[model samples]
Target chain A: MAKILASSKDAMAHVKSGMTLMVGGFGVCGLPENLVHALAETNVKDITLISNNGSVDNWGNGKLIANKQIVKLFASYIGENSELAEQFISGQIDVELVPQGTLAERIRAGGAGIPAFFTPTGFGTKVAEGKEARNINGKDCILEEALLADVSFVKAHKADKLGNLVFNKTAQNFNPLMATAGKITIVEVEEIVENGELDPDEIHLPSIYVNYIVKGEQYDRRIEKRTYSSATS
Target chain B: MTGVSKKERIAQRLAKELQDGYYVNLGIGIPTLVANYIPDGMDIVLQSENGLLGIGPYPLEKDMDPDLINAGKETISTLPGSVFFNSAESFAMIRGGHVDASFLGAMEVSENGDIANYMIPGKMVKGMGGAMDLVAGSENVIVAMMHTSRDGKSKVLKECSLPLTGLKCVKKIVSDMGVMEVTPNGLVLLETAEGFTIDDVVNATEAKITVSENCLVGTY
Candidate 1:
């Protein structure tokens, strides 16, 4: 079993600058805050960050965005970060706006060792300008390549010494895929239990893919979006 | 196809046809309007392919929850039991066909049921969002928009020459001029906006249209 670290900072010691990193999260949910904070303290720069959402303002991947550490971002939702928007609009940063499902498949395929897959996400628009398209069954499907990363960061609920991880509810986002798809996978779990204590069926991600496990710090369970019914309704 | 001044009216009519308890994905722009009107009591589920399901539309300026927002990067709220997910898990539902229906907008739809939405003649556009997944993965796909472009060119064509979003994925098209269904047989004219006929719609379209027995133009 690989050693478990006490903090994300120690687990992230394996990272280097200018490497492509995949961070798992959808907006604010299932975000790896500890690793993000750890990455923040590092002198690394010029990272290509891939995720579903660029964290809002001063949180999640927003930490990297705030530090101006990311050189490129491959994401579905880019509007959350005004800094990203400014950089994109100013041509200072590289941005690839992939369709949400297509982005997921691209990341998954990359980790699965699949080179490329075809889809109809952006077949005939600006997204398809330089891409190849083949007609299958009279429908136009475009080819999009896979994505692999130098590093992957994931958040989970629990993990035993063997590194098998279990995530609760919404935390089961890109963590599993990122676990398998990267050269170095860093996981932050709320709890680390005794080896063999977790049921095999409950293990969302097997130990083989995770290179490092860090016990997460206590958290502030902030709600990203709060929509309450009308007060008078 | 009726004039451009009636885009919102057609969408309003389409929103009226929605049933309760359906999980729906609303595409950008006009389809987003479907959220503004949800008929008070229908329990329609709204999914945004960027990774949010059951997102409430933007609240009024004074009522805006600073944290609430949809995948479109627009502000929104959540209903009870509404859980937040990572980007990966949210998309799995979309690609796996968990979404019930999706309301979309299009620039062109063909007689053969092809959609040309994400492209224009010469503009440099980017971002496809989850239009493809929503169209391919959802059960029912509804397109809402005007029947023709600003230059008097009809969006209903014999074949789509622009770009394609999804193939034969559009189930219904609700336009200011009329409402049509994409059947295995062909495009069936289901209903029309006020004062429009099958011949009138055909004259404005590039492809052939089949008129259904239940066709009725909208009153508003």
Candidate 2:
């Protein structure tokens, strides 16, 4: 069973400076907000982060970027975070832009104990540059190595005492995959239920992948773009 | 159509290519506008790479859910049959060729169907997102954009000056001036947008284009 923690401070205690971390989210959605906030308060520096996108200028992983905690960032998109862009432009940060699909697969591969995989997604482009290439079944493919992290911060809607997780709607973007890719997976949940309260089949991630659980106090759940129909307005 | 802008016209023209039961992915910018022009009664499912399928219209203000959004990160609603999955599974559907078509915006498109849209070197370096996978795996790829850059240089080029997102992938292009098909023989002009003459398109296009004999004047 995963150990239940009362606050993010306890969970973040295991994180050290210069560690490789995988953060689960697509922008601000599904992000482990409490853990991120706790990490921002820490004095840790030179961390390497792997996520789908840098959240916004003042929230999520962007806070870490603004705090100068991250040295390297691996993400599919960097359009949302101005701080990250400024740092990347000024040579203060290093960024490796992976294709979104490829990024997801690399994390999944890491959790599955696969060293590397060949994919056709980035072939014949800048992403394929400096990588091994081959013609397989008449399709041009490029090799991409798996990505693993020292720790992972994941967010879920609910978790059983046994650590089974349930995520909300489209918010489940990278949480489950990142859960297994890290040596120590720390999850922050909105609610904690009894061990048998959660249906076994409904669990999105099994307890075997989680190491610690922190009950989140707040979820801003900030929408990056709040587009709505005029009729409804 | 008279009051429509070039971007809207491009999206309007691209919407006509959709067939019933087609599962399509729309890139950000003008490609997202294609959803507004989808023909009524057509059964089309929109896929967002962030992990959603059967994406519906923008949510009503009261029904907005921060957890639910499109690939562009805009708040959106899901249709009746919409399903949500993880990013890995979402990309699996994309890379596995289950997606029928993908409409994307481009910075430059070569006569040979090579696309350069992700980076501008030291100027603008936004990441590629899922464009590489979409172009590589979708059954059909279509580009939607303006005919010329802001400075009047034609974006339809003999070779892309910017870094490529994909090579020999784009099958068609719908721009403000006209609709073009990328063929082994080079670009073929299939139609000219309203208010633009064939000579105007020829002059704006830097790529060598052959005008099809059946070329029609586009109504939209």
Which of the numbered candidates is closest to the native, going by highest lDDT? 2
lDDT of prediction 1: 0.75
Candidate 2 on A1-233: residue-level lDDT in tens? 69999899988788999999999999888888899999999998999999999889978999999999999999998987888999999999999999999999999999999999999998988899899999999989999999999999999999999899999998999999999999999999999999899988899899999999989988786888899887734
Candidate 1 chain B: minimum summed lDDT over ten consecutive residues — where?
Answer: B119-128
- Report the TM-score of the second chain of model 2 against its true counterpart: 0.97
- Model 1 ranges with Cα > 4 A deviation: A137-139, A218-220, A230-233, B1-100, B105-126, B136-139, B145-169, B175-178, B181-189, B192-214
Question: Model 2, stretches more than 4 Å misplaced?
Answer: A231-233
Instruction: Kindly list the per-residue Cα lDDT of model 2 for residues B1-220, writing each as its tens digit.
Output: 5677888888889999999999999999999999999999999999999889999899888889989999988999998999989999999999999999999999999999999889999989889999999998876999998899999999999999999999999999999999999999999999999988888998999998999899887556
RMSD of each: 5.5, 1.1
- Cα lDDT tens digits, model 1, B46-137, are 87554456776455545653334565445566677566554566667776677777788888888767777654533433445667667766
User: A103, model 2: CA deviation in Å?
Assistant: 0.3
**TM-scores of the candidates in the order shown:** 0.73, 0.98
lDDT of 2 at B46: 95
Give the top-scoring candidate (DockQ). Answer: 2
- lDDT (Cα, tens digit) per residue for candidate 1, span A1-233: 55688777787678888999999866776778888878988889999998877778778888888888999998766655677666667777787777778888888788788999887566655566788989878667789999989999988889998899887654566678877888888888888899889988777778998888888885655557554445555
Name the 10 consecutive residues with the lowest summed lDDT in model 2 chain A: A224-233
DockQ per model, Cα: 0.25, 0.84
